[model samples]
Target: MSGKRYRLQKTERLQLKIKLLVAHGSNCWWCEEPFSPDDWPTFEHVNPLSLGGTWSFENLRLTHESCNEMRANHYPISYEVK
Candidate 1:
């Protein structure tokens, strides 16, 4: 298979974000801090996409843009939704 990764559509991202917010609240999954107006919220893959993670909701999370960047593509030892 080609190495190209599938990108989520804008609408699909928005829908997933809404579902994440409802299921896990408006807090950063990595930092556990509430998103501020100035903070950019982003979808994070619990299992890094580089490590073969999928775009499904079960593997996604809402986190601050900074947190996601800091995390990069490192796979965590354990993950639990709060």
Candidate 2:
């Protein structure tokens, strides 16, 4: 597979991971606001996955698209879990 195709596959799998989390509760963990599947969510890293947060529930969170983008590659900002 081409590098681009591989990346797309990885992205799809990552999206599936996010979907599983959202299906249980399609809302922002911190803000407690519902998020539609089509609304676009951020696959937030609880402890900066690179810093070692797993793909498990405890280490993931769903947030607004913009919120996630703002946090890209940055340490998680403190947010209350509702």
Candidate 3:
């Protein structure tokens, strides 16, 4: 991976999008909102690629475009389910 943008081919992008969608559906990772018909889907970086996060399926997630934008590069705080 290079600095700045994490480049991906169209096929790769589509594949990633499909994988994330399957894993998380069309929900917003940050807000837990259901996707709207007019909403666009985007990849939310769990740990933030800018902060040394990998672009792997484990780190990427499906989210509403607006939610991803609002969250920016900030990873959400996780609470233990115990």
Candidate 4:
């Protein structure tokens, strides 16, 4: 296992979470489901940070905690923006 643990600091992570809430509202980027208040959310890197993705808004997504676990280190699917 790669012992390197990659992460954003607490405050920066919180900022990213706030941005995710604004950008995606209650939607889960991986599963496309609305988030319930009880569901904990996580920041998903659309482009895997391990593969050189930046911690920028354009590359981040809001997802349910479980969904993010399922999507680790993978590129997200593309869709035409309407």
Candidate 5:
């Protein structure tokens, strides 16, 4: 199990994304901006995986791809929704 990594399946990821979108709308969790046609939506972990975060729905939020990338693997101190 040391070299093996666990990842969400495509269908599972899609389901989670859809559920998050329906619950939170298309807003980026970090920036609180609605997603535009040019923006790509992605799921971000509130606690980074590097810090032992799980892929559970409660730990995930919707964000822009760019925002997620900017966040990287840092742990979030607080989530301010503007």
Candidate 6:
């Protein structure tokens, strides 16, 4: 390791990252809700973190809880990236 320590624990970091990710996106990727800072939009990863993804702006997206759950463990091949 490079001797850097994490300011937040793994769980805390994941929570914070999800919050910030939704805030930065500001709307559901599918439904287009008017997201607010207080609103806890579902956290979505463009590439599954379990598959070696990282916490980056480009990898984050805003989604509804139901949508996120439905898409979990599934990847769509025909998604139109814009």
User: What's the TM-score of each model vs. the native?
Assistant: 0.83, 0.50, 0.74, 0.72, 0.81, 0.52
Per-residue CA lDDT of model 2 for 1-82, tens digit only, reads: 1112112356765775556565657776556677776775666666665565555555567777766665655665654332
> Which stretches in model 4 have alpha-carbon errors above 4 Å?
1-6, 78-82
Task: Residues 2-70, candidate 6: write the lDDT tens digits.
Answer: 222323467865676666655665677756675666665765667666665555656667677766776
Off by over 4 Å in 6: 1-25, 36-39, 78-82
* Candidate no. 5 TM-score: 0.81
Location of the lowest summed lDDT over 10 successive residues in candidate 3: 73-82
Relative to the true structure, candidate 6 reaches a TM of 0.52
Candidate closer to the true structure by TM-score (higher is better), 1 or 6 = 1
lDDT of 4 by residue, 4-50 (tens): 33677898788778877886787887677888879968877777778
Better of 4 and 6 by TM-score: 4
lDDT of 2 at 78: 51
Model 2 regions more than 4 Å off: 1-15, 22-24, 73-82
Best by TM-score: 1
lDDT of 4 at 74: 64
- Candidate ranking under TM-score, highest first, comes to 1, 5, 3, 4, 6, 2
Deviation in Å, model 3, residue 65 alpha carbon: 1.6
Q: Please, what is the whole-model Cα lDDT of each candidate in the order they appear?
A: 0.80, 0.59, 0.71, 0.73, 0.78, 0.59
Q: Give the Cα RMSD of candidate 2.
A: 6.0
Clash count for each candidate, listed in order shown: 0, 0, 0, 0, 0, 0
> Lowest-scoring 10 consecutive residues by lDDT in candidate 2?
1-10
lDDT of 2 at 55: 54
Per residue, candidate 1 scores C-alpha lDDT tens digits across 1-82 of 1223488778977877888999999889888999987995898888788899878778888898878887788876553333
